[model samples]
Target: MSDRQKGLIDALQLVVPQVELRFCARHMHVNFKQKWSGKSFKDVMWKACRAYIKFVFDEAMKEIKDMDESAFNYLMAVDPSHWSRHAFREATKLDCLLNNMCESFNKIILQAKDIPILTTKYIRRLLMKRFLVKQESISQFEGRLVP
Candidate 1:
């Protein structure tokens, strides 16, 4: 959710009103650093984002306000639910701050599409070998779980 473009954000919100929208903490940190630079600020920002309790999040925010009122205000302007763990919906059960996994999967899919025939052949062989190995190892497992 780092797009930051008003139209894009609005469009996404409108399209998927039921989905919980969140900004990447890493991208927010980079943007924040560009405007204000300090290791302590970054640490406090991360602390606030990672806080799972309201009290802890408030404490971290208090520290930020004490250090820089403007910075605190800037953060306050952004919706807490979009970045803070304490404000996140527990129902979603998502603890991730970035979309790296989705991005990686998208890249893989795009690559496969660009090199369809070769990639299909390679992927088929890879999956066959992987499944065969897993199938062989499955019989040796002593527990109900694969591991």
Candidate 2:
């Protein structure tokens, strides 16, 4: 997470003690690449992120340290629970690294998002129309499954 994001999380944690924060591996990789560039480094970084077992994660970290101690130390300074699958809370059942769905939804609502709060009626009607169109299309499906 960026310094601003970390600050926000820190503040939020004071208010909501139970809030669970997770970082996107894609963003972490991009940040890491900005400092260290190499296909081998990228592969090892991803390997560490994707490791589902502590032993596997440790082994990958060993390889990273062997290749570049600084890179390994950088990763060690960050919380593993935020980036590595091995330390994720089982209750969340979150299996993905990136928030692609949220990003896609933001893109889909880009036009609607620009409407001023004073003119909510126009946005509301637009959203209603969109919802109706989606409902009609969904109703056309003959199978039991919606997808």
Candidate 3:
């Protein structure tokens, strides 16, 4: 582990409820490689990721173990080096709420930074517009029907 991660773990050790250190899913998929691609493997990997999203990390691990014990054990043993589940779980609790916020902030900065600087009113209007659109889209996105 780097000095940064070690320091983070040390800080987390002091906090109650523990910390979840998650490896980003997109980051892992780009790094790990397989000898021969197979539909079953992809399905299993996605299933494991979806399980984590369900907010039941242990259940996800159990699913992975049932699918392939050896692979799951390998992943658990060297998790941060190979998987995102442990990292995500460690960073998910109350103390780490800024993770997602930081991502969203970064995205907004990246998109808006290049635009001409705006006054406070303009920024507020922009935010309100985005909020309304997002609120409108939520129901559609939440539904599971084909549209």
Best-performing candidate as measured by lDDT: 1
85-120 per-residue lDDT for model 3 (tens digits): 334444344322124565675576565565676544
What is the clash count for each candidate, in the order shown?
A: 0, 0, 10
Error of 3 at 128 (Å): 12
Worst 10 residues of 3 by lDDT: 89-98
Misplaced by over 4 Å in model 1 are 1-6, 109-142
Model 3 residue pairs with clashes: 19-90, 20-89, 20-90, 20-91, 21-87, 21-88, 21-90, 21-91, 22-87, 22-88
In candidate 2, which residue ranges exceed 4 Å CA deviation?
Answer: 1-6, 112-147
lDDT of 1 by residue, 1-147 (tens): 453646867887799878788888888888888877899999999999999999999999999999989999999999989999999998988778876865665565565667856987866776688789988888778987766
Tell me each candidate's TM-score: 0.73, 0.74, 0.36
Mark the regions of model 3 whose C-alpha exceeds 4 Å error after superposition.
1-18, 34-36, 52-74, 78-103, 110-147
Judge candidate 1 against the unseen true structure and give its global Cα lDDT, from 0 to 1: 0.84
Q: Which candidate would rank higher by TM-score, 1 or 3?
A: 1
Q: Tell me, by TM-score, which candidate is best.
A: 2
Query: What are the clashing pairs of model 1?
Result: none
